[model samples]
Target: MPVRIGGLASGMDIDGIVSDLMKAERTRTDKVTQEKTLLEWTRKAYTDVNKLFAEFILRTRESFGLTDSSSGFLVNQSVRGLKWIRRATVGDVGIADVSARAGAANGANELTVTQLAANWSAASSDGISAAGQSRSNLASQFGLTDEDVVHLTISTGTGTKEQKVQITIENGMASVIKTSYGAGEDGEDSVISLLSGKDISDLSLKELTRQINRADIGVTASYEESIDRFFLQTNQTGAENTVSFSDE
Candidate 1:
């Protein structure tokens, strides 16, 4: 005879009771599985965080290499490691670049970008001097009349502080002469526009230029006949080079 089972003498459903008991056990196993999945996700998050920190440390090391004079600033290897974007520098990419390195000193550095260092320039109101045509009379060539003065004052480290030089014309002529031509001449103004006490008298424009260059005033006055333009500029760059004048 086979083994007698369930609901018989007891009038109870033994199969249904055993099935419900197994389901309760299954619930416990399922809870454990979900917890294990959550733990794996947390481990992945921590791994990603550690990776970010490692990358930051690598960049910091590169920065240090650039700043250390022994390594040489902006070396190709160090700059490449820092990952400098081309956009960090201002102005034309083909012309300029910018970067930084570690420094021994600690102070706030002020970066002022006033209009790029440029020469003081002005165009003649009239086209008196044109390009390709040499004029001996710089006075008329530069649109100068009876009382126009080219006042050039040099206030820079590379020049003399007491320099209040002036270039002028008289009787439609001027030349760089070696003497107090008008420095203290009779009936002359105390400060005649003669450059460095040198008298410039009725000389051809070319000869006059040769003489002016000999003055050693740390400046050059050029007249481009092709463009019919005359310009005066100091021999330097940056804010220190302040060459002031009038377009007279």
Candidate 2:
């Protein structure tokens, strides 16, 4: 005997199947939303990591004459495993000298840089005498107008027991000479203050970094943070890379 199922009975089963499908679709939608949230959370974490690294580096900064409140800080999120980018340094003049002479005093008196160091004491001396006249004037009789920059050396001799070199030509009288062994990079603030006319307080980290990098400071650059780090990097590798901060 053949038993046929009626349309009403089948209808009920079909409705249940439809409902189940709808529920599956909603479940999938929920899963997608959760995944998106996780992604957002990861992004925020990365940003936080970058900020942390930047702050660490800033704190460790050895104060190489930075004045800007926001300078010397940087982060590059795209760079994996603790990478950093630094701005270039410009206006880094290794040597600068301006005296009363326009060109070398004379052919024979030409002072070489190498020899300048040995004769620095004599060159720094000051006395009022004639420049010399008609070749007959005695060398000592004439004013000691001949100044030679034999050499420029830095030393550490500016403590209580230490000594320095100072000279002045005023009122036709010469004072006792003192040699300066350049005090171990101490008193640097005073040196900076002594420089006038230019705003040493206002410096461009970007330009300075560029100059240093070009000079082969061996630094890699990236933007882990929004702004740039205002300095150049050194080429020190492995454990030698102390200037950059770690992401961990």
Task: State TM-scores per candidate.
Answer: 0.34, 0.24
Candidate 1 residue-wise lDDT, 1-248, digit = tens? 79775597788988899999999999999999999999999999999999999878766765654434454553334453443432244455544465544322334444555556665544555555534444655543455555644543332234223223444455443423222223355834233333333323334455555545555455566656555555556666665555544333
Model 2 per-residue lDDT tens digits across residues 172-201: 322223232343466432221111222212
| Best-matching candidate per lDDT | 1
**Candidate with the greatest TM-score versus the true structure:** 1
- Candidate 1: lDDT of 10? 80
Residue 146 deviation, candidate 2, in Å? 75
Candidate 2 residue runs with Cα over 4 Å from true position:
1-11, 62-248
What TM-score does structure 2 among the candidates reach?
0.24
